[model samples]
Target: MRERPPAAELDAVDRRIVDALQGGFPVCERPYAAAAESLGIAEEELLARLQSLLDRKVLTRFGPMFQIERMGGAFVLAALAVPEADWARVNDAVNAFPEVAHNYRRESDLNTPFNMWFVLATETREGIAEAVRKIEAATGLVVHPFPKLKEYFVEMKLAVRGEALS
Candidate 1:
């Protein structure tokens, strides 16, 4: 078998592009042009860099996070304690639901049993329980729901390590 090629490395310009658009993305008719102008690069270059960053897995997502509750929708956090032997099967069963928005695997401490966590998005608040029921029935594991008590707006922005970004 051929050895896989090494992953691409991020350069100074790529680092700037990653850090520059962390909190606020341009919202103008020519948003790319505006953003590119601010970064001292052409719109085409910026677009290319963004796509490359995505392709390299340096950036997982680049978009707005919607406040679903404002639109009469509900987003619930739920989890399950999946057995190691049945992880793949249980994962498939849970992800089969249309209401599932995001799913994650968590390392459980000595006392905790819940290992799989996910978010459920539904059109109505009552739909949360129904989704939980469906997931429980499908996975044969008890679903634990954690309702959000407070919301905080936190922007995740960081300069490249050992580099003076500002």
Candidate 2:
């Protein structure tokens, strides 16, 4: 993979935007405008900063967080014991599915069987199994699924502030 250029340093406005948006984005017909109003900036400026952040790779993705189970869907944390040589190929093959929400490469202990971990979100419970099967078939590796047995916290948001905002 090509290395990404360093991200540009954020200014006060940019920091404020990130801080404000991270808490919870407005859900309205004019969400951006509402968000900008709360942040004491014009809608256009807020949008421009957001776009710039994305372009500079400061933010990889900007989207709503979903509760799959509440939406009649399911999600599972799965891992694969991928050989070092096949890392790139396996990563690509597993990520090819839309159901694969995110993937991470982690250092494994000597006794650990899996090295690559990922989350699979699907429209239905059965979809999770189907996605695992497809990934197994594509990568020729067993996907060990760790489904949630108990409910806990859903998500966490980090708060960032510029010197001025702070």
lDDT of 2 by residue, 41-131 (tens): 9999988989998998878777787898998899999999999799889989998999999998776457586888999999999999999
Best by TM-score: 2
Which pairs of residues have clashing backbones in candidate 1?
none
Between which residue pairs do clashes occur in model 2? none
| Per-residue alpha-carbon lDDT of candidate 1 for residues 76-134, written as tens digits (9 for 90 to 100) | 99989888899999989998999999998887458478888999999888899999999
Worst 10 residues of 2 by lDDT: 157-166
lDDT of 2 at 132: 93
User: With candidate 1 superimposed using the best TM-score fit, by how many Å does residue 2's alpha carbon deviate from the native?
Assistant: 25
Give per-candidate clash totals.
0, 0
Whole-model lDDT per candidate: 0.85, 0.85
| Residue 61 lDDT, candidate 1, scale 0-100 | 83
Instruction: State the number of backbone clashes in model 1.
Output: 0
